[model samples]
Structures are given as C-alpha cells and as structure tokens.
Target chain A: MSVTTRRRFAAVALASVAVLAVTTACGDDGDEGGSDGGQITLTVDVFGEQGFGYEKLYEQYMKDHPNIKIEERGKGMGLGDYNTRLTQWMASGAGAGDIVALEEGTIVQFKAQKQNFVNLADHGAASLESNFLPWKWNDGKAGDQILGLGTDVGSMAICYRKDLFEKAGLPTEREAVAAQWPTWDAFIETGKKFQAKSGKVKFVDAATNTFNSILMQTAGNGTGYTYYDKSDQFVLSSNPDVKSAWDLTVKAIEAKLSAGLQTFSDPWATGFKQDQFAIVTCPAWMTGVIKGNAGDAAAGKWDIAKAPGNGGNWGGSFLSVPKQSKHPKEAAELAKFLTTPEAQLEAFKALGNLPSSPKALEDPTLLASKNDYFSNAPAGEIFGAGAKDFKPVYLGPKNQAVRDAVENALRSIEQGQRKPAEAWDDALKAGEAASK
Target chain B: MTTNTADRTRRGRPAHHAQPPRPRKARGNFGTRLDLKTSPYLYVAPFFVIFLIFQLYPLVYTFWVSLHNQPLGGEGEFVGADNFTALMKDEQFWNSVYNTLGIFVVSTIPQLLIGLYLANALNRKLRGRGFFRMTMAVPIITSTAAVAIIFGQLYNRDFGLANWVLGWFGVESIDWRATKWASWIAISTMVDWRWTGYNTLIYLASMQSIPKDLYESAALDGASARRQFWQITVPMLRPTIIFTVIISTIGGLQLFAEPLMFSSGSGNYTGGTLRQYQTVTMYLFENMFTRFNLGYAATVAWALFLLIVIVAFINYLLTRRIGSAK
Candidate 1:
C-alpha cells in the first residue's frame, strides 16, 4: 500500500474512534420509548432518604407494570450537596436523572431557570393540582408552567421531653405545654423557668433552629419586608421579621436556653439520645430523624406540642422531571404517582414526611394513627394542624443563601463568639450581600 | 525495516557508510507494514487529545466565563473585568485568602518540620525498620475524606478525644469551630495529619539518597545526630525540600476537602459559621455551587491561580538563593 494511503486510512480510523467515543460519552438522547416489548427503565435521583415510602411505591408500580424498570439514586448526602450536583448536571445538559428531587429552599432558584425543567402541566400535571395543598401546588408552579409535583410538606411542631418537663415542674400535658408558650417570648420565659429549676439541661436544641422557626413564622406575615419584596428586590436588611427573629434567637442564646448543637450533627444526634435538651423545633420530617436518633430507650419519653407563635413550615421537597430525560412521559407519570394521595399517605405512615396532598392530610386513617415513639402523640393531627396554618411564603431566588447567612450569625451567637447586636448586623450585611 | 533501507538507498546514502541489505517479505495485508517515524506520534496522541479536551478546554472556558456575568445554567452577559473588581471588594474573598494562608502556614511548617524529623529518624538502622517506614505511609494511603471525618470527630468540642484529654488537665472544652485560631488549628491538624506522612516518605527517599559518607564524616568529627541533620541532611536535601514546598503550597492554596468536611460535612461550605477556616478553593466552590455565581467563582479561580504562581515563584527564588549561597 502507498504510504499516503496508509496514513490516510490510519487518520480516518483514529478520527472515527474518537468520534465514536465522544458520541457514547454524550449519552443516548432517547426521545421515544416503546411499550411493545413491555420494557422501559426510569431513573430517579433523590437526596437523603426519600423517606416517603418511594422504594415501596416504586416496587408496587413496577409490579403492576412489569415492563417498567425503576432505578433510584439516593445521594444520602444532605440537600446542599444534592442541589449542587443537580445544578451541575443541569448546567452540563447531561447525566441528569429522569426525575430529581428539589428541596423547597432551592426550588425557587431552579424555577428561575425554567428552561432546564419540563412543564409538567403540558403532560396533564394540572389535572392533579386539586389533589395537593394549594400553596404547595403553587410552589411548584412558575407562571402557567408546573415545573414539579409536590411530594411532602414540612409542617412545624415542637417535640418536647415530657419527663424533662415534669422534672422542671412544667406542665406535661400536650395542650398545657402548647398553651404555656403561645408566643416566642412566652417560650423563652418558659425556657428560663425550666433553666432555673433544671440543672444544666437546655430548653432548646439549637438557637439556629429557633431563628429559622421564628423567621418562617413571621417573614410572610402582613409585614412589607421579608427576604424579598414583590419586585424581587432584597429586603433582608430592612425586614422587621428578620430583626425580631434574630433578636429573639440572641435572647435565647444569652439566656442559655439553647444547647448550641448544630442540627443533624453527630453531637446533635447524641443530644437527642442523651436527652440533653428539653425541646426540639420539630418539622414534620424531623420526627423521623428524632426517632431514628432517640432509639428504643427513649420511646414514649417524648411528646408533640404546638410550635410557638403562628405555625411555620421548615422543609418540604418536590419531584421535578428534567427536560433532558429521554422518558419524559414515563418520568412524569412516576413523579405524579409518587405524589398521589394514597402514595403520600403511605409515605407519611412509613416515613415521618408529612403529606402535601390535602386529601391525604384529611384521611381518617392517618389522623387516627398514633406514634409509639412520641408517647402515642397524634403526629398526623399535630402536623396536619400545623400544615393548615402554614401560609405560602414567597421564597426569593437567594432564599437559601439568606437563610444560611442568618443561621451562621445565630450560630456565632450560640457559640458566644458574637453578641446579638453584632451578629444581627453581620447577618443582615451578609444576607444583603448574598442577595446581590 | 526493509522500507527504511530502501528509502536510505533511494535518498543516496554516504559513500563511506557500509549498509547491510535486508530481504523484503511478501506484503500480505495493509496492516503488516508500519510507518515507524509517524507511529510514535500516533502512540502518544491520545494523552494530549484527552488533556486538550478535558483539561485545557475547561481551563480556557473558565477564563472566558470569568470575564462575564455568568450564572449557572444561564447565558452570561458580557461584563469584562467587572467580576474581578467586585471580587477585590468582597470581604469574603480577602477572608478566604487570609484563612488559606493561615492554614497553609500552620499546616505546612509543622508538617515539613515533623516530616523531616521523622524521615531522619527512619533513616537510622533500627528494629522493624520496614514496618516503621510502612506504618509511616499508612496515613498517606487513607482517604482524605475519611481522615477529615475522623479528625472532625476528634476535634468535636464536647465529645472529641482531644477535649477529653484536655479535661484531665482541668482545661475547659475549647469551641474549636467557633474560635478563629482554634478552627484553623483544627483544620491544620487534619491537613497536617493526612499529608505529613506523604512528605515524610518524600523526605525519606531524598535522605536515603544522601551519601552515608557525609553523615559518617560529621559523626567522626564529634557532630551530634541533630547537628548532622541540620548541617548536612538539610542542605543535601534542598532540591527535594523545594519540590515538596512547591507542591505543598499549591495543595495548601487549593485546600478544600479538609475544611469542607471539618465544618459540618457538606452542608456548611463556608468552612465555619464565621468562615474562620474557609480556604480559597472552598470560597470558589461556594460561589460556583451554593451561590450559583459562576462568574465570581471563575474570578476566584483565576485569583487562586495567580496566588499559587506568585507563591511558587517566591519559593523557587528562595531555594535558588539558598543553593547559590551554599
């Protein structure tokens, strides 16, 4: 063979290999799926435990439709890492799962980038809107487009140690406990009383939680200032509610009411097991975490009470189908199915995640159910009542950033590194800066 | 083989040069003959191709992104030099720079000193020499993430073994994460623990290469082991020390995982509540992912690159100066 011909052939072969590799690495854009062979695979990506009986629901769904294969990728890391990974995937326009979980704090940010997600309303998502909480349904909507399906709502409650309350000569009854702290100031007063009687035990787990609960309760109230106004201008520095929450949290820290443990830390978990704190600012999902950490030794030692002041929402998540998914229809179907009233109820019963579906919230079976872990606390009713009082707060695009800044400021106070006024100023400055 | 001789003959070889005739075999297939000159280029092309696509492309793209008001997953507006100006005024950027330098000094100094000492000790003939050397490398093989996690637990203010030990001396528990210096010390402990052994191994290899004759002469002249280490070992190991210093400076400037994991795992990327331990890379990661400020993150990346280059150059000059003085 001529040298030039051999050289040309070699170059062509190398080029073809490179091209093949590039194409394969980019992945298959399977725009269509066939039901003829009764086979389709769906991948779902979630952070932490989907705790929502998703595995069981997926199993049930796959059994009913034997042709469909479902693969779930549980990141197990917390929400921050999960959101970061999802954002990277979305930006790169590849390697995204068919369905992804979006936490409420980050949902607004994702909603702003509407091009990355499929408008679920185009695929009959609107028809199921009536099935979910109105606010939750709206949260998943960006204008007319429904970007996600509501999965769970994190209605806030207070889980207190009944034995510890008795030890401190405070009321042990759930109703009496709830009435003692009708306002945040009353709660702090109760904490002081408890502290004077009880030796070293703290009234609350962390001041940061107090800050978040109070902020969520007051941010969307009639006040004109919240994280942002209607025009999306940052109002953190001017927000009266933010100032109040920060001040109250600072008071709690100074009064030594907080145990100063960062939530979900190993020490925090240890605090639960050891009963180091009297009360935990319990979001609906936090019940699972509490129960998991408290173990069998602490069973029936804890009880549920109403959160101080007006009710607030702490956490919740939505299932979003990315536009990059090859099986968009199937993915949408799975997302809708996972969030259905029955599925949501099952999840609530199996995991502690509160149901976002209004119908599921009203289910007699769920309401009648009691948890042995919390002295037979009617968790469903407590969370349901909390859920009812939860108003839909408009979370700005930088909501997580603002929240994190404030939380860090609260942490500094809890650590005794900064005074309330100084930390408050720092927090406001950081929050405003982050908003920009 | 036959083609090379044939080509040489066709090109007219020097008359004085003697050549052996090679017999040509029947060409059965196109694959049988190989182009030796061009084949080496083909063999080494894959690494360069992959490097260009994966490394160089992203680097150039990052520089381009730095010049714009890039938001994640969105088209960026052209805003040349604006991001850089904003970064200059950003207190968090300066804080990160300070924290990174603080941690780099705290970690690298102790690490190099202890590493040098350990290498010197290991160089001595002793019982279980192989075992001791192998054990020294155990921390190096352990994953950085795991090391960070274990160190985090150990540094816990309330429950850690460190505070537990301190309790024996009537010392109150130090809030490692809250205090600026304490947090740096905690993070430095993590960085030092993970890397000291690796540096020890490097120093050990360099120390082993140093002529035994120099050490013997020092010993014969009544010089102590310590003096030998100072006078002969250190000077002899200058180039290796320089290499490790350069590598450590680059690694320290890019310190991310230790501080990230140390500060409550993945949730708190600011490194601490006060960002007392936030490294430059952590700051870059925070802007890129948490804040979704891609342009700012790119700017931080460029700044870090510049810092590393400047520090490495300073190190090169210092090493050269020392070498020349000797």
Candidate 2:
C-alpha cells in the first residue's frame, strides 16, 4: 500500500480507538445520577433465608412510597460467600449494593472499616435506638455512630423430638426436659441416660453445634471468655471458657452422644426426618429449618426447651447502607423500617426469625404466640428469655476464622480423627495462625 | 538473478526457461494486500490486547502484591520478601503442596491407563460406534460442581453407595474426608471420573490416525491382539500420551473445585475439617478470601506458577528424552 493510504488507515484506527476509550471512560461513572422522573432503585444484597421476609417488606414499602423501587439480590450459598462478595465490593469501591446484610460473624470486620458504611445516626437511625434490644442495638454501633440496624437475633433453645424422648424414657414435657439439664454437665448426664435407653438414636444431631452453643454461652461471660480481648489481641489460647467448652464437647464426643453429622448437611436434614437423632442445639432461627426439614409427618413430634447452661446467641444479622449507595437517605430509611418493632414482629410470625427489637418482644401477641411445629411450644417465651440474657460478645475482625478453627477441632474429635488434647492444641495453633 | 542462473547451470537444466520471476501486480481486495503486509496483525490484535489486559496484568500485579503486606480494605505496607519468607515456614503451604502432588499422582496414573484401555476399545470395529464415541464425552460435558456434589454423596461414610457396596463384602465403612489417604482417593475418584472420558477421546482421535497396516503386519507376524496393541498402538501413541500428561499435570496442579465442593456445600473452602484434601489452589483461596491475606495469597500464586513452570519443563525434558530414545 502507498504511504497516503497507510497514513489514512492509521488515522481511522486511532480515531476509532479514541472513540472507544472515550465511551468506556464515560460508561464507568456508575448509575449515580441514572434516576429518571425522581424515581430511585435501591439494591439490597442479602444471604440465605435471612432475606426471606424482605420481598414482602419491600413490596409493602414500595406501595407506600411509589417514588422508590427496591431490588433484592440474594446469595443462597450462605454467609461465607456473602461476606467474601461484600468485602470484594467494598475493596473495589464499586458494585456494592445500596444496602447490604452483615451477619453477626462478619459485622465486626466491616465495622472495623467504618468508612465503608454510612453512619445511619446521621440519617435518623438514632431516634429508633430505644425500639431495639440494648445489646442488639449496640452490636450495630461503632463508637457514637450506628453503621447498621439490627434485624433478627438467634437465641438458643433445645429442639427435641417429644416422641423420641418418650422412647428414650426421658421427660417429654418442655419444662421437665429443660429442668433435667440446667448445666452442661447435667446436659451430658441427661444425654448419657437417653443414649443408654435409646440405643438406636443419638442424643444430638451434631456435636459441632453443642460446641458452638457452649462457646457462645461463655464468650461474653465478663471474664476472658473470648477469642479476642477489648484491644483486639488474640486470647483464644489463654481463654478458660474456650478450653472448658472444648473439654465439654470432647466429653460429649467420647460418650457418643452426637449423631456424627454436620449441621445443615444433607445427612443431618435427612436424620431429622428419619429420627436418627432425638435432639439438636437449636437457635430461634433453627426452628424454621427444623420445621422445613421435618415436613408434615414429624409435625408436633418436635418440642422446644430451654438451652443447657446460660443463654447464648447463634446467628443474627444487621442491615447497613453502604457509602457507595446513590440514595443513602432512602437506604437508611429502608434499613430502619425493616428493623422496626412492627416489621420485626411480622417477620417473627412469618419466618421464625426472633425479633431483635425490645418492643417487639413486649408485644403480647408475639410473646403469647406458640409454634405448632414444635408441639405448640411457647417458643416466644423460651427464645425471648434467651434473648434477654444475651450478652453482646465482642467479636474481633477474624471471629469467623477463629470460630471455624475451634469448630474444626471439635469436628476432628467427633470424627475420631484426633484426641481431645491434640485437637485442642491444633485449634489454638490454627486460631492464632488465622487471627494473624 | 545471478544466483538463480548459477543454480540452473549446476543442475544442467534449461537456463533459458528459468527466467527471472515476473513482478506480480497487487490483486484481490484490501484484505489480500493487508494479509501480505503487516495488517494481518490487526486481525489478531484483539486477542493479544485482551490477554495482556486480563491475564498478563493480573499475573504481574500478583507478583507486585506478593512483596507487600496487604490485608483486605487496608492499605498495604511494603514488606519486601517477608511474605515469601513466611510462606517458607508455613506448614499449611507445604501440606497443600504435598496434598496436591498426592492427588495428582493418584488421579493421573489411573486416568491414563483407563483412558488408553477405553480408547483401544473404541478404535476397534464395533457396533454403535457413534453412540459409544458420544458417550465418552458425557462426563466432560457435565459441570465439575455437579460432579463433585454427586461424588461427595457416593463417598459419604454411612450412606454412600461405595460404603454399601463394601458392606456386602464385609469391609468397614470409610470416613472418606477424615483421613488423608481416603480423602486423596475420594478426590482422585472425582478427578478421574471427569477427565478419563475426555482423555479417552483424545487418545482415540490419535489412535484412529495410525496406519492400519502397522497393526495388520503385527497380526500377520502371529502376534496376539494384546501383544500387537502393546507393540504397535502404544509406540504410535507416545506423542498423544505426552500431550495428555502435560495437560493433566497442569490441570491436576490447579485442582480446586472438586475438593472445595466435596468438603462442604455451604462454602467452607477448607477442603475438610482437618484440611486433609486442601490442594494448593484451595489454600490460596483460603488465604486470600477467608483470611483476607492478599499479599500471602499472591505469594502462594507465584509459588504455584513457579512450580507449574518447573514441572512442565521437567515433563518436556522427559518426553524429549523418550522420543529421542525411540
């Protein structure tokens, strides 16, 4: 080709490249000002069944406020994936939902990076503080700023098959059954008795939940019953509560009280239906899972009792408006509305997520309600009492990793892969390594 | 022109007919002219540009990140070779490397043998030829996640088909995820199940191209079918075998999804309770995502890259030596 033609071709290519670059650069400014006709779409990212009640809540909210549109994105893979995605979005400073749900496990990690979320106190969240439980409300607070609003609290309870208990010659009544195990030692003894009589079925679904329940109970016990201290130093190795919990879990494993299944696993769910195990360490939210897994055939066979030892909290979540949100005010308002007493009560009734709001707990309808799935057990009373005693555990940035390490130790013992002492050493080492 | 005349005189051919080449005019469209010059590069530029942006940039950036102490959401501090130094002392890192190699060996050997056997069977004159060839690709088409989940159930301690089948022969049930060897075996079974059929197709494609006369001569020499296969088919399949080995080695070193899925369905990427089956990729994922240690994760990535390069080089040397010996 001649020089003129080559030069013309180069010019055309350069012009096209410049056009592409300009368009691409323009495309990246995001949907910050994309709203048309004063209408805004707020995206809410959540994980698992925790987001179950939001669709109805969003529909109701949209009906009330026509100018606002809410879009929900859910990851059913559970909290690990949800937290990873949230962290990634936060790190990239883009693609984060207007509002994101943070589980109790990872909320502190997000709270540590306080700038990632908008201070809801600046957007009228402080006025609603009296509506929520003090600990649940405080759990969402970083210093004077509220980063999130409490949604649900997972208060501990013992879910057992009444018929299975009867077969095992144990007390079938909720109060009597709860009376049999006031402490963990008593709980272990009761498990022994049940197993001695009922050879076919184990006492608990999995020892891992028992370990977690004990850990939760001991975590906020005012002593150094924590993985991290107030200064966020690793104290897992020196924590007596952790050691005691490990010992108790080891004892349970040694006694063969566990059905040797992982919680939420397919086998564990199937075991629930087949009555392979008589009991499970149920938090308030687990009642829903149990009911779903048990189906209609096992309907009133299951009952709820007070959890062994002092009360503990399992899973809970908070809703936070990200700083990247286009409409922070609207997102905060939606978050506030979702955690309101009325909304919490409705959610409790529909989804079995125990209310985090103190006023919702005071509501006579919720307090008097019985779960027919749990043999008409007064679940409200049991979980409410548990929630009342729920002390706020100061979870460190690596709480989930630490918890996994401890739980992995318990699992190894349960699987007969390691002795308790070796597992304990392994847990401490792993916990320290992970925390670092 | 002088060189051409000299060459024609040396060959004692007709020098008059060997005239200087005529100048050809630019013909066809702009595409033909462009192809003759440098413009063909423009056609392939998109792929190279994309590769540079996506693959090459991340790789170089990963090496840069490895020199820092970056935590998620925290501004990384420059730490020089500290991350690599820590990796050297990290037991989990070495454990992962060991697990990866163990899984690779267990998976690859059985996969190659079974694939070779299947390919030989498929290359014969058989009924339902098309159907059998198509069936060989079924496993390759299935998603790895689905395969992992299905295999997890089949390897479950109390309820798996494997344990039940063993029970019939009076063998005890094995907790596949609890022990190192058992976990390796379970993960290997998953890897082999997915890739054996794919490798079989590869081998069969190469096997079909081999001259039929070689096998016929062996048959005429009174060699047994098995002997002829060993003598002729195996020798001709060396190149394809080497290619599969390299491919499988690369794939096995980067094994991630099966073990991750096999461990727990709820996104626990530790590989197992004890991390008995945690391959190197899973370890990197655990460090990067779970622990939020980006710097260390990047170090692991670099280590994995170096390991792959070294292994691939050794494979090349071994194959070349074998080819030369033949």
DockQ of each: 0.42, 0.40
Candidate 1: residue A421 Cα off by (Å): 1.5
lDDT by candidate, in order shown: 0.85, 0.85
Model 1: docking quality category? acceptable
Model 2, B178-257: lDDT tens digits are: 89999999999999999999999999999989999988888889999998788778878888888998999899999998
Candidate 1 regions with alpha-carbon error over 4 angstroms = A1-34, B1-36, B265-267
- Candidate number 2, chain A TM-score: 0.89
Model 2 C-alpha lDDT per residue in residues A1-436, reported as the tens digit of each score: 6999999999999999999887655543432443443567889898874454666788898877766788989745566667778878987889989989888877888776788789999998888879888888888988888988999999999999999889888889999999999999999999999999997799988888898888888775656337887788899988787778878888999999998887666666778777889988888988878887889999989999999877889988899988988889889988888888899888888878899988888789888999998889998989999988878777777887887787888888888888888988998888888888
Q: In model 2, how large is the Cα lDDT of residue B97? A: 94
Worst window of 10 by summed lDDT in candidate 2 chain A? A28-37
Q: Per-residue lDDT tens digits of candidate 1, residues B1-326?
A: 99999998967865545555454666733444566566888999999999999999988999999999888888999999999999899999999999999999999999999998999889999899899989888888899878987888898877789999999999999988998899998888888888898999999999989988998888999999878877888888899989999999999999988888876633487878888888899889888777889988999999999999998898778776543464
TM values, all candidates? 0.90, 0.90
Q: Least accurate stretch of 10 residues (summed lDDT) in model 1 chain A?
A: A25-34
